[model samples]
Target: MPVRPLSPELAEKARNELNETDENKMVDSLQHLKDWLAKQPYLKARTDDQWLAAFLRGCKFSLERTKQKIDLFYTLKKTAPELTPLKYKDPKFSEILDLGVSIVLPKTSNPAEPRILLMRPGLYDPNKYSLGDVMSVGAVIQNIMLMDDDNFVVAGGISIIDLQGCTMAHFAQMNPMLMKKMTVAFQEAAPVRMKGVHYLNTPPGFETIFNFIKGFLNEKNKKRLYVHNTDFESLYKYLPKEVLPTEYGGNAGTAREFTENTKKKILEYSAWLDEEHLYGTEESKRPGKPKTAEELFGVEGSFRQLQKVIMIRELSPDLAHIAKTELNEDPKQTPEDIKHLREWIMKQTHLKARTDHQWLVAMLRGCKFSLERVKEKLDLYYTLRTTSPEVTLRLKPTQPTFINFLRLGTCIILPKATTGLHPRVILIRAGRYDPEKNSVADIMCILYYMVQILVMEDDSATVIGTKIVVDYEGTTLNHLVQANVTLLRKIVAVSQDSLPLRLKGSHHLNVPSGIETIFKLVSAFISEKAKQRLKIHKSADELFEHIPKDVMPPEYGGNGATVAENIEYWITKIREYKSWMEVEERLGTDESRRLGSLPSDEAGDKGSFRQLNID
Candidate 1:
């Protein structure tokens, strides 16, 4: 765990640049700062002398700056809860460290040599760990570095971020709020001077992520940002091979070796990390009111503010006219009618919904503002929510299983809405489905979430219906065997009878040899009229004939964006609706008032095999 010490020649050079000609004067400055901190009742116990010296050096022996930095550092640790209670021994921490996603190179004291920190975000597994976990490790690493008087504070460090294999799945795991806190902690609180940030092998559409990080950076650090754009030669100019690890074509040992050594070094400093946990700011000691998380990190006028952004687009005049004509209602009466429906539904004995105007409007549009149909569907929707706990309760989008399922890129919503087609195109990659890991209920929950959001976005689209394209290239017999028949029946029943959606069309593409079995299971729940809309295609060409390639992903010879890009887009949208989903979680039907309905306790005793055919 012993790190390489700085060479004498480099030490002298750095000391000269820092204007630390008098060693005794620097020592006195640090002592004065510690003494001042000890007298402050508002602050916690003084940190160790080594940490004090590191801060002194980081601020170039400036006592005032060092004191200011120390206060902010501890204050951030207190305000940002994620930074405290350091869990270096946690299994998730070990897993992330073992992946070698982020590694600090061996220490070098040479002011000329860059203290390089390498980060390979692609090494992160979205299914195993979240971005918050990654940032937690970062806080620990930064703490360890802060304790190092020679390596980090003396010469500073530059980062090389490799985003070669980064995908939407990885980006989706990033928590913006946590990211903002981490950025602020590093830039304002920590003593490390970030010399430069180099992004190597930058992927497409990285601007979205880059801009996000840039928002938190100060003007000075913004100038230090350099995107290599797949150019390693440019990176080599700043970070020579001799200083980099073998993985980056440098003479240093393999990244794995450096990773293991650094991890062991961190483990050895467990006591220090534990002590650091108790050193956060005591907000109660503040002279004035302490800042909230939103007050500190929430950006004003940023698109990231979900509450401010209007997610539901206004219905066009043509779509509004279509709804009026189809439902036999006056165009101007739709708003009042929806309000009435909302009030009436809230009064119903069986259904329990907060019944917001937006939700009511979606239902009205789904049934083309037909009051009777809206009432029926509303009753059935709440009933399903109440009974189907397996699907509704356990299916959280934040769950690892759901995240991995989305990462499979099996279920994709096409970016472009097809002309003259009211329903949005949803492409399902059946081959990617692993029945062993996932049940039909899981799939039903995901579909329900997606359709619910889509319906709310556009009422016209819900009325017209959703188009589904199932790609069965990889479907297997094992998948069919593992499919839960009971869940599948419930899914179909919910879609056909309860959900506010039109059965536009179902296209089966790259139909597998065993598709007949899958088709039979799916078709059993729908009517003959719905079955007539099912189209089976042996190849992409045949599938394209029914559903134009223009509205499909680029991978399928379409003009729209790639499936990965589409996934990224939807992931952002899904995150924005997290608040709405939380409200929906409480919604259900009170079945006690229904005629012949069993009591809540006896409901489970009744046969679970009662199936509602969608047709």
Candidate 2:
């Protein structure tokens, strides 16, 4: 059902109290708010009139207050994700929704009355559900009022808390910091005007906590506080039985009925609810220092312990020549240029990241100091890490799972660059790991880490790009089967989009006959530019002709370090950056805070990998 219009009495109250006398003025103000929202860089806010109107009336058409409330309203979700993500699939949310823990009572036709926000915390098991879950569910009900109930918006609402079966655990969940977030969420974020709060069936020791909590409440709420303690007669003076649930001896449907309908009403506005989580303040663009969760909610500090990353800034004469000629990198200006990019990244609201000088410098060198392209590269780099955790966010370096895989020597980054141009060489041994025990994706994960190590520390890899050599010496039907279109496409997308390592050449060696069938399937997915750089070597002579002897590992009769030695080197390197990875693992796009379209062609080929020309 559509939201019912306010009766004449309520409409007149809005005109007098809310300063909504001039219809033309309200339209102009709404348009002005929309215009202001358009100019904001961080907030992907909703533009609907009904949505914007709630904030306006909540402040009685005071433009400045409305702006502050609007910022806080969206900022609540961004700062307090624990209580803000009240999605439909959350089982705890659904369970509480069914329990009738918090439900709005049926609005009576008496148009002057405000909406009733009923809360029964005693309905839920304190041990099974935390206070955050209850408040998240309650947020949904409160927001439903902000959207659907005119009386709730214009006349405001009252809250009734029935502390019947509550335990000490319930009180413990309402810690100081949590209380602040919940307060900001309900009051400033939702901006529901509170008429009064009546506490029913108050347990022993409730007064102390309640009085302490009064400090967080406004002056208006402190006066409106009432403790009824199971006295329905006393409560009846303030709230008539018609507006209360049957459990409270009212004529309205039972609490279950109200809950079922409230859930349905929530489903009705589900789209708006989903979008609400996406819109929030760009704290970076805020007037003062960007608000951290600590600043916003007074919770624990938001700093992470990261070890200093040792950056190898020294470049060899050969690599320096290649860097300037092939990569367009001028050594003189790169240090200052890296600082500029770092400053830009610090100001970004979406990139909640603190990268070291090496990583930022690597990005600049990879994109050859094109500021725009480097920004794009870093954004996608973090986006994939944040958005695709299972595939890319593997940061546990000391864990046995990754450590064991590193010893397999399936993927190795040769320390020596090729002669002349000094491009780093990475060798991927296709047959090193048994396909039954390890899939292609597993090895790809190892390759992913190795390439990350290459770009961050190696000047040649960052500036002149890296050469990828895949040697399929041990060919099998099972290995080919693992190289399905889906897995290969993700591998290709990661190679093409996310990684900062530019591809100087892609060389394939020792290809078995059945691999031809696999190559045909993979050819359709790789980019045309990547396809042009492709080189298939039939013999050791042909492969050696493309990659010099010094660049090849000792296993291949080159001066480069043996596979085992390189694996040990990487194992030690991975251990050194464990702390750094712990912090970088948290740095990914929230997706919700992005201002415009997703960073261009982000996942590379996206869902249309098959729609490509094959030769």
Candidate 3:
């Protein structure tokens, strides 16, 4: 039986479709598109509508599917047109520029020759060219277009390293369009896994696999595509840099060497680019040098002080009233008279709510330092002095805010002043407070309340340096993650009792119970002044003489012990589980063992056991 000759016009049409050099021109024309659509029986079901309607529906669907591919092809042509021009010229991987398939040629080889379309499936870089695979694809198409017949064998190859790490699989997942295009182009394209390339750390696994793709493509335009898993550069180094014309170098042997070198350089440049582009990693920290004054005190500290000064001056009238009418100090400057003056600055402006340093600095500039000078001297004087105020004033502190940072979930920010040594931190939070009863309306508000206790202290770190932390918990419309470090610290002073109890029943009341438990512990702290008064009888008398016996600490009643001693005695009894430390130590080993065996949870829960259970 003899083979039938294809009609000249049909042959020319096939050639145009398979061998045309321009990708844009290669897009099937509208008539050709209609013809192709007429063939798909499943899709043709929807073609019962009028021609225009069917055409519109098909156009919409096809446009959506082909948009990315068309864009990618054109982008490749624009960026690397030189590479596109030579894909079908005796298509073989003799050199780098001739490395990949030229879109101009038919995607497959003829039945007569063993052709392979090598591709390492990967996520598209929008429009990337694999010289090896493209050349292989181009060569196969070239052979087929110029072939005497239609049937041909084609196969793909990927690097063993890529296979090992699942790179091809990941690529397929990211770029399904590329996979679809390649699959639709070659239904009978066989998969050939070759463990032939060793990309051992020269370039990446992908580059080496690419080079092998070229190697397999240029192989005698045979019907069978042979893929080798090997690094092309390593193979390039081992094999002749220049393959002769008889050796598949074709007519442009000299240009091939230049092409190969260019490919290697491209690989290197791509790698360099990859290293330069960083995303989630931390930047390298420079070694330490001398610290600037701002760094030592913290840039935030100055702005914070500036903010305080502003708030203080804004309420100067009230502060002056307190200073003059209450403390008997002149409002105007006279350093001596201004000494030991103390006043609390209430925060009401939304400006104070912002944590940005620039915003704070700008806000600080608006403060009249000249007017605050007297206030400033008084402030500093009060900080260093031991004199107590005649009247305690209530200052409203901002609520603590929590943020979800990447590393930590819902962390309260520790103030900069509270860092770097033995530092002290004040946490602040806000919750609804019942003014009538001077008690928290909600139990959970205590978290904010406890945080507020730390935030409200006037010059809290008088005798010690500790870290200050603030967290804010409020019903924000934004579902805030616990990542923002700056905003988290602002609301630390907020009382836990303020937390919203969305749940019903005992859970709602439990929130406030928890708050009281914490407050009980906090109110137990002895201030430095109180501690000092516990020493020397005269000092104790000076401190206690102003207050009634009922109000005075226990030692002032002549308990044959100072207040500090009495506190220590109580602490010892509570801690040792005996009236005296000596008595606790005298207990036999069995008694000590029993005490040590108590469950930790049970011990702590005892503090609020009744309240927690009742709630």
The lDDT leader among the candidates is 2
Per model, how many backbone clashes are there?
0, 0, 86
Compared with the true structure, the alpha-carbon lDDT of candidate 2 equals 0.74
Write the number of the candidate with greater lDDT, choosing between 1 and 3: 1
**lDDT of all predictions, in order shown?**
0.69, 0.74, 0.26
Query: Could you give candidate 2's per-residue lDDT for residues 1-615 as a string of tens digits?
Result: 222446798789889889977667678888899899887776667777777788888899988898888877777767787775556658878998899899888865387778888899988988888887887788777766777788888988888999987755677677666666777777677767888999998754465467557756888778999989879899999998888888898988888888889889988988777776566777778666776677776444522111111233556787777778866878777766776777888877777755556677777777777888988878766766665554564434546788787788878888865446657888889888888787777777777766766665556677777788898888688888888665666666667766777887889988888887777766776667777989998776787877877868878767777888988988866765564555655667777877765564233344332221110
Which stretches in model 3 have alpha-carbon errors above 4 Å? 1-174, 180-184, 187-615
> After superposing candidate 1, which stretches have Cα over 4 Å from the reference?
1-7, 84-86, 107-111, 287-295, 298-615
* TM-score against native, each model: 0.50, 0.48, 0.17
Q: What is the lDDT, from 0 to 100, of the residue 485 in candidate 3?
A: 24
Of models 1 and 3, which has the larger TM-score? 1
lDDT of 3 by residue, 1-615 (tens): 222333454334334433322223223443444464455332211111122222222123244333323223323333223333443222333232343212121122222222222222221121343423443444333323222222121112212122322233233232222322332222212112121332322211233233323332323322332223334444344223233121222232433353354344434444432432221111122123322323422334643442222111111354344334423434243222212222112121111122211212111221221234333322222211111111011111121111111012121212223222222322222232222323221222222222222222211221122232222234121222221222111121111111111101010111222344333343233223322332212343543333223323342342233334433432322232112222212221122222222111111123221222232
